[model samples]
Target: MSKIAVIAGSLYLWLSPGLTMGQRTSGLIGVPDTSFTVHSAYSKAKKTHPDIRIAAPALPPTVQANLNVVYCNQNGRDLHIDAFYPVNQSTNRNQLPAVLLIHGGGWRSGDRSQQIPMAQQLATNGYVAVTAEYRLSTEALYPAAVHDLKAAIRWLRTNAREYNIDPDRIAILGCSAGGQLAALLGTTGNRKELEGTSCHTEQSSAVQAIVDVDGVLAFIHPESGEGDDSRSTSAATYWFGASKTEKPKLWHEASALTYVDKSTPPILFLNSSVDRMHAGRDDMIGKLNALGIYSEVHTFADAPHPFWLFHPWFEPTVSYTVNFLNKVFSKK
Candidate 1:
């Protein structure tokens, strides 16, 4: 057998001892590739709000976009980031605050393009906004995606002058899985262990604020319903390369709640009616409150998990995000 096939076979055996070699191989290899895209999300959203439309990806007259700019190069894979900034920002005497937008696809799917419209809107609102591409579970794994995002943050700071960005005033915003990552990044900033040895090591990956849209804050909390494998290996399973029971420490380590401290930056939770999606949010907020840190929560009534992808919700999502960033970053 080829080396890859042999390895895959070993993985099957390791992942599921109960299954026969053939059954395990089929289960492992038959996993379908995720098809999480703007169109797909729109279709899902339209089922409930038929009149809702996908937000326009066009840049506003006052906004300028630099698409597909490579920000990190890892082992020949050039991760790209799309940057949107206000027109004439180059001439501005003051450095503009920036936000990096991360998309959600259960940490396995979705691309930077998913947040293009949000980036454009943020740019129009006078902030330098960037949507980053990170390695997904299919490409790498858990900490790999985290490392890629941190690299993107460092890259932004490294090029802050060129982008007219205030390195210290940056925020990170994400939806769903991306929101979980944004929250984790906010809490784990400057932690040497979580900081991957990727590009821009000299630059810090710390964010001044965080906006998490319907993302869970803990993978192993009592309020969390993650790691349900009754149907099949869950998204978290694929990302962690093991089940919660198999790698409890990994699950706890990835949870943002594990690293919450006084040094953690302000956070905003924009959630939908789906309670499980925002699991552990309240607990984390309570911790922040005890630490005297700033935090806000805005829940959309009866909204879909991917509400940010569609019309009515999209506009409000943008509004809330901008307002929260303004409130948090406006502070010293």
Candidate 2:
């Protein structure tokens, strides 16, 4: 058997002894048991995919980075973005594709800096990449973070020429809470209500693709509550300003799954096998497939919720993300 197949088989046996290979194809099986051990499965997968390494590859000499460029001034705060792009223009005069990275902290903490490494890496690989700041739950409520993200999209479009970016070829990538926002940004593109009266209102906030890294899809669905605890539920309550039961409509409205349709952008979901951070992800992928929209899901065996932030898994995460983005952008 191939090395990858052997590693996968070992992972399946170690992680989900109950499920067959066919059953694990969707990448949503094997919710981590509380007593689940870690490191071994990921270590095996790493050994198998040896090409995936932690060190960021050297960039071309022409790559440039600009930090703390203000994208918006909202609620007495100046939202900033760190942009990384290549100085060398494309041969055909066509603008380069852009990517916006959103950081995650359950919509409460975390900052744009969390995604700086990825943004820089993307820029080095011939893309204009940006890491943007948005209002957290501590500063605002539910829709506020969403609005900030949409506004950031608008900001990119409005300043596309300045950054040598193709406005229509923009994609969004987010992890954890940011993943939820990125998913919502992709699904609710045409929804006028979610597009708040923030900066750059004239430009469309729609994205061409979405890369959601372990984000919740449905806030109130039964699957959403499957692996959640009181602390996670409390984070939702804090963000929405009410319990799910107290404001059912708000919770539903905030859910990305509620807005899935034919118009939703193609999505790539990267998740850890044992972590339930992205509850209802498989169902969301199923809905996207039903609508004929493109979707891909890859699960790293025995990985943690924040796998992308560390070594071994981080390399695979970036590889999959760059490949997916390249595929989606090339067709546009």
Q: Which structure among the candidates has the greatest TM-score?
A: 1
lDDT of each model, Cα atoms only? 0.85, 0.76
lDDT by residue for model 1 over 251-282, one digit each (tens)?
89889998999889999999999999999999
Per-residue lDDT for 195-262 in model 2, tens only?
A: 88869999999999999999888887766752233655456675666677666788788888988888
lDDT of 2: 0.76
lDDT leader = 1
Off by more than 4 A, model 1: 1-32
lDDT of 1 at 239: 76
Error of 2 at 247 (Å): 0.8
Candidate 2: where is the Cα deviation over 4 Å? 1-62, 90-92, 226-233
Worst 10 residues of 1 by lDDT: 18-27
Clashes, model 1: 0
- Can you list the residue pairs that collide in candidate 2? none
